[model samples]
Target: MRRRIHAFSAVLALLFVAVFWISTVVSELFLSAAAVAQVKLAIAYALLGFVPVMMLTGASGFALGGKGRHPLLLAKRRRMSFIVANGLFVLAPAAVFLSIRAQAGSFDSVFYSVQALELAAGAANLGLIGLNIRDGIRLGRRRI
Candidate 1:
């Protein structure tokens, strides 16, 4: 049951990352006022949905690790830590800021620079989470 829960949570996290990336790309491509408002609404909804999914993913990961000292588990934990920190400290705030700036009709060079940084950070998070998922699978198979 724990294994199943962990697998489910990991898949959920992956799906969340994919959706976020898609939304980011779509938001970037459509910059009109109507499109911006719609994209902002989508982003807001995504953020609301992401919080609980991330919490479940982390909790299930911890439950699976359960004080074990396996190297793969440790690596997975570290990657998850990076994801959480980056999401909370960087991506979320940047998204909110960008949305506010868009609503305010401000799209200067600084906004683009910040958006680029946010995209990079988000991409990093996705990559790390993918690695973590691979590690988790290896740990499950006793191949780590």
Candidate 2:
């Protein structure tokens, strides 16, 4: 049951990040300012769901791994630390900031700059979480 929660939360969090990142990309390329603004607002609000699930992913993952020193577990834990930190420090604030700015139609240099950073950070988290998933699969095969 613990492992199921860990796996489910991890994958759900990954899906959320992927959607956020892709929506940013597609909106910027093709959507009007109003549409982009809506996307920003939506992403910001969406954090209510994303954040808890991500927190659950980290909590359950750590709980299941339980201070193991095995290299695979160590790697997953390391990636998870960065994932949680990046989500809290970088992504969440950026989402809110972008949403407010976009809401006001203030698509200035700062907004775009932050957007770029947010997108990059999102991509990095996506990859790190993906690697965590892969390592998890390997660990499962060993029944550890």
Candidate 3:
């Protein structure tokens, strides 16, 4: 049951991050300023769901593997640590700031600068999450 919960939470969180990253990129590339603003606001609003999902993911993952010192679990936990930190410190703040800037029609250098940072950070999180998922699959396969 715990394993099921962890798997579901992890996948859900991954989907949330992927959608945020993809939407942001597509909006920036082809959409208008108003569209970008809408995307920004939408991402921010989505965080309401994303944040708790992440928390559940972490809690359930830790409950399942926190005591294990195996290399794969270690790797997953380390990646998760960075993932959580980046989500909290960098991504969330950038989303709010970008949302405000976009709403104000202030697509200045600072906004773009932060947007780039957000993209890079989001990409990093996506990769780390993918790696963790891969490691998790390996661990499960080993046990089976």
The candidate that wins on lDDT is: 2
Off by over 4 Å in 2: none
What's the lDDT for candidate 1?
0.80
TM-score of each: 0.88, 0.98, 0.96
User: Which rank order by lDDT, best down to worst?
Assistant: 2, 3, 1
Q: Summarize candidate 2's per-residue lDDT along 21-88 as a digit string, tens digits.
A: 99999999998999999999999999999989988988888888787888999998888889888998
> How much is 114 displaced in model 3, in angstroms?
0.2
Judging by TM-score against the true structure, name the best candidate: 2
lDDT of 1 by residue, 1-144 (tens): 878887887788778777777776786786566676567556766888887888888998887788988988888878888899999998888878877877777778877887798889988988998898888878888933
lDDT for each candidate structure = 0.80, 0.93, 0.92
lDDT against true structure, model 2: 0.93
On lDDT, the stronger of 1 and 3 is 3
lDDT of 1 at 116: 90
For residue 29, what is the lDDT in candidate 2? 100
Please, what are the lDDT tens digits per residue for candidate 3 over residues 38-123? 99999999999999999998998888775888899998999999999999999999999999999999999999999999999999
